[model samples]
Target: MIRVNHRSGGVLVLAVTETRLTAAVAPQFKQLVLDQIEAGNTRLVLDLSEVGFIDSTGLGAMVGILKRVGSRGDVAVCGLQPAAAQMFRLTRMDKVFRIYDDADAAVGALEQS
Candidate 1:
């Protein structure tokens, strides 16, 4: 589940409500974002501030989302909890996605793009 907020300049901020993003939830999470993309929301800021843990499956889902958006739009991540941040770093996914300290910064950057 995600809390959706529509910001200016066609930016969509999706705050993940789950504490753990693992195999059990990755599929649904991926689908939800894909659905949003299908609905014309290309610019996205995925707020993972509330997600304390993320597994390989979760990371895969995020990657899938970014690939889905491709060159048509951007997908940035913000407010990563320590564990999630570490995972991103360890996997070097930090380089794959735009990361920000908070939703505002991510949204601003996406809006500018």
Candidate 2:
């Protein structure tokens, strides 16, 4: 499951409450982002602090979500655990996504621009 909260500074924070992000939830995650994009929000912050694991499909879903935002806004991911961080580095996705140590930092950084 996921929780999306719209905050000040046009930042929509999506918190992954589940322990793992995999094929099972990738589609739902994508759908959630899509729904928001269609509602006209692109500035997004994904809170992954609670997430314990992520697979390739989950990674792909994240990429797709970012693409959906396009150049209209930005995407930031925060609270990556050690394993998830390693997966991101291995795939070089760390370079693509703006990563933060916490939700406040992610929202602060993105809200500025």
Candidate 3:
């Protein structure tokens, strides 16, 4: 579901390969993220460059992932497609998550902290 690249400075870049994140895949997505966190990745960058569609469940999964990180670390998102970006804005979740235009930039920001 996601390619977890463990970077330096405790930053993990998660690149989702799926184009659509709906109820069917949201659970799996959430699990994948949780698994990554449990594997010791706290600083995260969720790269949604390939995701073109996302439903409510997908949004929930994203929020769930953020919650999973908790006080231990943090999660950021990057490379949101136009549709996904609009959906996040509509849901006002854009304000809740740190966003970046590129994955490296997100990881850099997370690592710099």
Candidate 4:
């Protein structure tokens, strides 16, 4: 479901491999990411380059993940496809999460934080 990569300065990059992030997989996706957060990976960059569709459930899952991190850490989103980007904008999640063009840029920003 996700390709996990550990970068320098304690940033965890989670690249979603699925094309659609909807009700069917949002729960599992949320659980997997929450597990990572519980495992001491607080800084995160969620790469959604492969995800072309995101429903309300998927957005909810992302919000849940961010809430899980809270003030203890940060979660940034990157590599959003056009549809996903539009969804984020329409939902105003663009303001809630830092959006980056790529994983490397997101990692750099989180590393600095």
Instruction: Tell me the TM-score of each prediction against the true structure.
Output: 0.99, 0.97, 0.96, 0.99
Q: Write the per-residue lDDT of candidate 4 for residues 1-113, one digit (tens) a residue.
A: 99999999999999999999999999999999999999999999999999999999999999999999999999999999999999999999999999999999999999999
Tell me the tens digit of each residue's lDDT in model 2 across 19-45.
899999989988987898889888999
Predict model 4's lDDT versus the native. 0.96
Backbone collision count in every prediction? 0, 0, 0, 0
Taken over the whole model, the C-alpha lDDT of each candidate is: 0.97, 0.92, 0.92, 0.96
Tens-place lDDT per residue, model 3, 1-113, is 88878888879899999999899899999998898889888899999999999999999999999988988998899999999999999999999999999998998899887
Per-residue lDDT of candidate 1, residues 1-113 (tens digit): 89999999999999999999999999999999999999999999999999999999999999999999999899999999999999999999999999999999999999898
Preferred candidate (TM-score higher): 3 or 4: 4
Better structure of 2 and 4 per lDDT: 4
In model 2, pairs of residues that clash are none
TM-score of 4: 0.99
Q: Name the weakest run of 10 consecutive residues (lDDT summed) in model 4.
A: 82-91
Order of all candidates by lDDT, from best down to worst? 1, 4, 2, 3
Weakest ten-residue segment in model 1 by summed lDDT: 104-113
